[model samples]
Target chain A: MAGTNGTIISVNKVRKSYYRDTIEIPVLNNISINVPEGEFLALMGPSGSGKTTLLNLIAGIDRPDEGEVVVGGVNIAALSESELSKWRARHVGFVFQFYNLLPVLTAYENVELPLLLTNLSKKEKHEHVEFALKLVGLSDRMYNKPGQLSGGQEQRVAIARAVVTDPTILVADEPTGDLDKVSAAEIMELLDRLNKEYKKTIVMVTHDPRAAEKAHTVRHLEKGELT
Target chain B: MKIPLKYTFRNLQSRRLTTALTILGITLVVFVFAAVLMMAHGVEKTLVATGSEENILISRKASNGEISSIIDGETVNIILAMNQVARTPAGAPFATKDVATVINLPKTDYVGITNVTVRGVSPDAFALRPMVKIVEGRAFQWGAREIIIGNSIARRILNARVGGTIKIGGDQWTIVGRFDAEGCGFDSEIWGDVLQLTDALGRSNAFSTLTLKLRSPQEFDSFKEAFESDARLQQFVPKTERQFFEEQSETMALFIRVLGIFITVIFSAGAVIGAMITMYGAVANRTVEIGTLRALGFRRRSVLSAYLIESLMIALIGGIVGVVLASFLQFFSISTINFDSFAEIEFSFALSTGIIISSLMFAVVMGFVGGFLPAFRAARLNIVSALRAS
Candidate 1:
């Protein structure tokens, strides 16, 4: 499936459904989207709008019933579970609203996690972790555990972890959903900076209008289709 | 850190109550395992370890222990001239004619007769077993009624210590001292002058056996050849020290070993089951965490390994604890009736490295057996369902 020269992710007429014994319920209705290099796209919808379903499909965490999902020049829809996992590790960085930092690990160790999948030496891993923490402006708090940090600071560490490997794209599912108003604003501002300063591609799913305002473009997901 | 070490610590730390309870269960199981092994060891150490390879007891044909054997004093002198006999400094063969008898002696705690062996010896008998030494008092007079008891007899029985009076059959004898042969089977015996016991019991012409020290273990064949070929005492048979003890322990050892296995198998089964429950609970408690690891790019094998490691640590802790506590059983002496001689013999616990290693290996196996299914369950988790669980 050839696309534009600079396209980073290509989804062609993706249709996904879930089976309940004898019945199949469609979640996405012939969805099609493309995110090129350095794009900042937002997926917006209210509750039950299939926004999360489409995000999961695009992220390669799940496959569409019948369609193509190509990211970073690889079709994840055709990959096996293990192959997809390796592909996700090297190509995709995911940030969840709960800021899923391993509670036992410090901020530094949390950001160092994804790099473990890489074959980097210990010294190289340390450099990558330090650089990622510094990028999120949390270098001073790297030794602090998630419980010791504020909600906003924990989210920043999550962002650092997502981008620690320098992947082609960052995907966030309601990145600011759990934070207070000020902390939510801080997280959105960090994502905007990641887009403009580092030329990072970001795909975000959000219910908050304020969060989507920071994205370069927004798509509304309703009833099984993106409008 | 590796996934196994990482999750093992996390699982133990996260469920403090369950972890402590599981460890306690394992400890109890291990304790029983160790205690039974100690009892079996005690029985063996009392008998087998006491015999010296170079010594032989010339008992009668078909006679087992000394209580069933008797040879005249004249026969003892005839066996001393054999070429394979070890010589004293004066070039006389290192041999002594003696009387060995088992008596009903009272223990400090048990009211029944604890069999205390009393050996009536000549002066040369001391040299025959150089390992024995008078630790508390002097040896008995050559013809006096004074007696000396072994260390274990003196410490474990009543009225048997140094300067105490003990009655054997109908005769009263004074315990002049306590002696030791390095806490071997000899430590539960009494020694007196042979002529006194012979004269008092009216068996003056008879002795239990002629004790001889051979030059080495290899000289047993020559020793047997010289003794058995003598036309004068054609029935006299020579036995190596180890062979003699082996004959004594043969029946009893098998009985004890079977008993040990029976007891251990019961406790080991309970322990293995207890470990299984704890490991399953561990998997149930950490299902979400396992799912999260799967979502984070860890392979199923790594997750399984992590759970197995955690179980092994717990089982190993319990096993080591059992062994340490079992070592203390060395101090406890048990009185078992020797069916061959019908005398209650005393035994002390003996620990061997084989027992410890076997116990540790058994614990590890229990960990592996108990932890498998749960680990498989953790590894097979669907990452989405698990992350969405709680």
Candidate 2:
């Protein structure tokens, strides 16, 4: 399943629109982009450039008004809601800008949540959670809650959670947007390790020049058109 | 659906004030609901526990209880002569003429006048009623203006203690003693000589009713025919004492049940709304957490069940508290008007396992009904939008 030439994401001219009190506000206008498996890609854009909209479409979180989004070679819009959920659990891992870790759970439990979807034994799941935490360089802080961890530590926990299921693609939205320079450098370093060492296909959306510098290929998105 | 319990609990803890207020509302509703059920059951217990399953009560046709029936002293003797009647070792029939009356007695604890029953009976009355026993002072003297008050009379009503004298019709009747009848309805009365009570109340020719213990249940028809065949009487009813007491409870039981359901419905509605408000706030506060769960690949059904489980936990807490508080009331006494008898009746809060179980079931149902919509909202949240909430 680890391949450098296979396309993990394929979008066929997808379009998205929003409505503000019956006024159709177009967001992603006739866009198509794809990242192969194990390829690290960055989406760089200004505000209101439809970069997040395209990310949402690729992650199976939103449906396109026209055309189709196929992730991991499965057309998501064609799948039922429950099927899409199962696909998301198995095919995609997600990391967000703010490191949206549930504040109640310890970092270990946060990492263990996605693993619960797999049919792994409890002992095996524990092993995977431990490895994911260790991979993110926060194995010692596994017992700490998100609130107890610093911004960088919280993002690392989020990363651990995203990778626990060993998914084909990692969809990250400004993964270092809230971190300081040192923490941002640490996070980019962790994503770099995930891409190079684990052969992860990371698709990150960011306005940060440094974050984009870490990606193997950086593309500019302006007014829903990719360049 | 696998729901992590820690998420729900932490969300509840973060909104401590709302959760506490919601639980308090549920407690109040459950308390009122249980109290009404207890009172209703207490009414049924008041009647059902006092009557014997095998005894026969002879009265004029169509009459209800001893209060509305009248029989002569000569008829009392003749009915005592029937061979179908059970007897003691002294060769006397197991029957007695019970003269029952009610007089207004001022309540010691409240401002209203409560009617206390006064029963005049013969010495064999004690022998006929095996459940009757003197828990306190001795029996009343025969053919004298001396009365023994029932235990309820002594404790709740004024001027009922032994050795106390009270005037009736300008003559002071001495309270020579007090007694109990093993918690039967007789315990609510004052007992004295039939002749003296008839003479004092100036209804000298009438004894209110007679109770006869049959040799067996087979003699009931013959006994009824014998009374109805008497040419001089026409209006009294002859029934098994058990049936008569059961008839007396129907109206009171219906009244209590209706009242209980009414209060519970009104209060439970408000509690359900309160639970809705609390659950809505819980869902709102945990948007990011929910988003995290969704992004971690949890199904929508899991989030729905998690919120519902949290609401049920609150309701269960309130229900247990209400039941515990109601159990404490087993030691207190309550008196209310019995609709069948049209007289004041004393009762205790009757506790049964059914009442407690039903109360808990009711509260848990409220939690589900109230929490379902809000939990659905959480489940249907947009993952990207939810994660972006500041």
Candidate 3:
């Protein structure tokens, strides 16, 4: 169910914290933001500014300490751990800074990882995996393992894995942090195309200014507060 | 969703050295476990196969074995006259009064001497035991100063082969034949005429045991009752030959099994620890991979089962290799002293289905114990913290 205001995600007064051996460390203050459908949003912050923390809460990878994180009209903060995992599998796709591809699997297998949780038949999974890889412009490198691929190709494979399930939301954390300027530009262009052409809603965390230029909206965080 | 088996398998294959070493540890422990069981089973089988169920052995009431039992000629005659005794074709009673004693003999390979059983038998003893076949030479004549050696004794004892002379009880006896007792306890003995042996030992008109063939195996109860109830035969005890021989092996077999299992338990501990260390290393190295799997929506249960399956596969491989290694032990014979008779008996290790199942189960248990903690740790990892690991 879409929000009445055409929002796909609604975070209300979300707060999060980290603890180190009984020492409470506040990471995110009472920050709230709403993302409209098919919107590409970038979150920028200095180190320890809680920008990635906010992205994680919105992506359903972490629960907010004192707020409701409603994605696609479901209160994900109220879901049990196992229920949250199933929900994440059905709705969220992730692209991490390190590519996070299993080294033993080929690019094709890596892309098919998320679909293993689905009830899809082998043929259906193959079709989805092929389309995702082709969408990321890496269909030719699908048979190569991570060790055999370039850093850019590995991140492209990660993106293919992210979209193979046709998830409701795409979340990227430092997607260009490990790539060269040329490869980083290519990745940002792919994200921009996914948003504008494929109508995918994307939330990204990055320190790269040029990467933020591709998003529809940009938010900044200082300390634990949004500015 | 369940984790793919190929994922688990490839992880094992990725660390070849650790996997091989852990498997080797399990294999060694399983081999020892199987070999011990085989040894104990072999001793019981060899002794149990020595007796025929239809035959009854009469010994002194309080004696341990034929070596210590004594039955006079008059009592043997009285027992042979009973109707329960079987008859030969010539209508004579199928009974034999045999004398058994132990003599020190030099072993062919070992430096020290070992006790060898020497039995003095009646002429009809061969007719009673059909399993004793002459494999290499002719049977000894009844009245001659000749003897027959069992195949095991002929092979292991110095100068005990056919066409050789052995001095026993101050009398010279020529070895005339070699008989195979189908790997029974009899294969560890030497047989000769009872009269000549009794004369040589100066125990005239007395024998050590009276062995009789019953008219039918079912007549054992009545025969034992009749023999024990007779006033003249009251000092003698009768037991089915099978029961007596089986009892002969119980103590030694039990000892072997208990001692072997104790040692196996100690060795398996080391093997379990080796498996644990290897599994811990795997979990430590794959922390990020586990997080990726969890983030992809694989349940914690799936992760636990994947690690356990990996460990089980390693142990199963080890079990197979160990069983194959233990199977080869059947070709080599070992000799040990039968505590009841104080004579050395030779038998080969025997593998059975029960031992194989036991050994494999033991290995699986080790795998389960070793893999549990590491798998639990992997499953309990916090998704956010795990993903943050480099």
**lDDT scores for all predictions?**
0.79, 0.82, 0.91
Go through the candidates in order and give the C-alpha RMSD of each one to the true structure.
Answer: 3.6, 2.8, 2.3
Greater DockQ among 2 and 3 belongs to 3
Which tens-of-lDDT digit does each residue in B293-326 have in candidate 3?
8887888899999888889888988888999999
Top lDDT hit: 3
Weakest lDDT window of 10 consecutive positions for candidate 2 chain B: B230-239
Please list, in the order the candidates appear, how each scores on TM-score for chain B only: 0.87, 0.87, 0.95
- Clashes in model 3: which pairs? none
How much is the TM-score of the A chain of model 2?
0.97
Q: How does model 2 score by TM-score?
A: 0.92
DockQ of 3: 0.73
When 1 and 3 are scored with DockQ, the better candidate is 3
The CAPRI category of model 1 is: acceptable
Worst 10 residues of 3 chain A by lDDT: A55-64
State the iRMSD of every prediction, in order shown: 2.7, 1.7, 0.9
Q: What C-alpha lDDT does candidate 3 achieve relative to the native structure?
A: 0.91
> Model 1: per-residue lDDT, tens digit, A1-227?
22478888888898887778979888788999888788899999878778888777777777888889888888889999888777777877888888877776789988888888889999999999999999889999999988999999999999999999988788998999999999999999999999999998999999899999999989998878889
Model 3: CA > 4 A from native: B60-64, B71-75, B221-239
Per-residue lDDT of model 2, residues B1-390, tens digit only: 376787777777777888888988888888877887887777677677666767777676656556777888777777777667888778878776778877777777877788777888866677667777777677777988988887888877876788987666456889888787766666777788887888898888688888778888898888778867865444556678777777767788788878778878888999999999888888898898788777667889998899899999888888888888888777777887677666677877778899899888988998988899988999999987887775
Worst lDDT run of 10 residues, candidate 1 chain B, spans: B1-10
